[model samples]
Target: MRCLKMLVIAAVLMFGLTSCGVTNHMISNYNVSQTQLVLSKDNFRVIGDVEGRARATYVFGIGGLSRKAVRENAIADMYRNARLTGAQAVNNITTTVKVRSYPFVMEYEFIASGQIIEFTGE
Candidate 1:
């Protein structure tokens, strides 16, 4: 009985000191700037992958822009690094948000990634 009590106290201390985090993820389809452009298996070839990340901190749930804006900022950052010139497009865009909580502070990290493809002559 004494050993059991000690174990319970240890467990409680461990849990109390541990911090928990939450994550939200989402994936979007093709988001090319061109609307009339048609992409097929034979029309495009995978060139490489592009990724971008953005982070913001909140205290007492007050700070930074809205969630949608943050996501857009991440995607915009990805585009800046994509270096698209011509006949290039990015698809399979995915966005993931991770929120880490500590005391009265929370940090949110957003990551956006996609596949960069270049059109191939038919």
Candidate 2:
């Protein structure tokens, strides 16, 4: 009986701590400027930094919508924001979304940057 009670407590604790929102650190690492372009020299290109973020209906625990919908919304927002900000090009994009604690759901941040590469043919 004691062992059963202990197991139940552990399960509850685990459930309480589990999250499915997102984090800023993960979003900061994604690249979205590729689609966004700016006028550079004579040609238009994506430049500058790209970032992403998610807005959850619930701070934690995937309360409002389906996981797929939430993810799509977040990515769309990032793209929209990045494009609006005037980026030349975004590359090497990554994201991480997860819930933090209970009743404190949060969305991770997105980040991306554009790099100019030069080729010299002599």
Candidate 3:
């Protein structure tokens, strides 16, 4: 009976932790600014590339920022890091979400990336 009970406990623990390894990936595009401009063929040049990442965790479905807030925070972080000048802008923005699911917790990582460009002419 002792061996049988130990076997049952081990099985239950294994089953419980199985959800810890689950992960999901998602990608989407968003507009960070209201003023949209069409990049001219020869008016702007790529200055560099930038990326911003943010993480939020929730346990038992309660904690941290909401999904929408996390995404916005990631984009805002990217802009804060860029420190764009008067004639500089960020383009080709993409946001990636990494979700790690556990039995009682969820971890989210939001990554925002884009290329910085500077206009050579008006």
Which candidate should be chosen as best, given TM-score against the real structure? 3
Which of the predicted structures, 1 or 2, would earn the higher TM-score when compared with the native? Answer: 1
Q: Candidate 3: where are CA atoms >4 Å away?
A: 20-29, 34-40
User: lDDT of each prediction vs. the true structure?
Assistant: 0.82, 0.49, 0.81
Residue 93 of candidate 3: its Cα lDDT? 84
- Can you tell me which runs of candidate 2 are displaced by over 4 Å? 1-46, 57-62, 84-89, 103-122
The total of clashing pairs for model 1 equals 0
Q: Which stretches of candidate 1 lie over 4 Å from their true place?
A: 1-17, 30-41
Please, what are the lDDT tens digits per residue for candidate 3 over residues 66-99?
Answer: 9889988988899998999988888878888888
**RMSD each, Å:** 4.0, 8.2, 2.6
Candidate 1 residue pairs that clash = none
Ordering by TM-score: 3, 1, 2
Clashes per candidate (backbone, < 3 Å)? 0, 31, 0
What does candidate 1's lDDT look like per residue over 62-121, in tens digits? 998877777788889998889988888877789999988876778888999988888878
On lDDT, who's better, 2 or 3? 3
Clashing pairs in 3: none
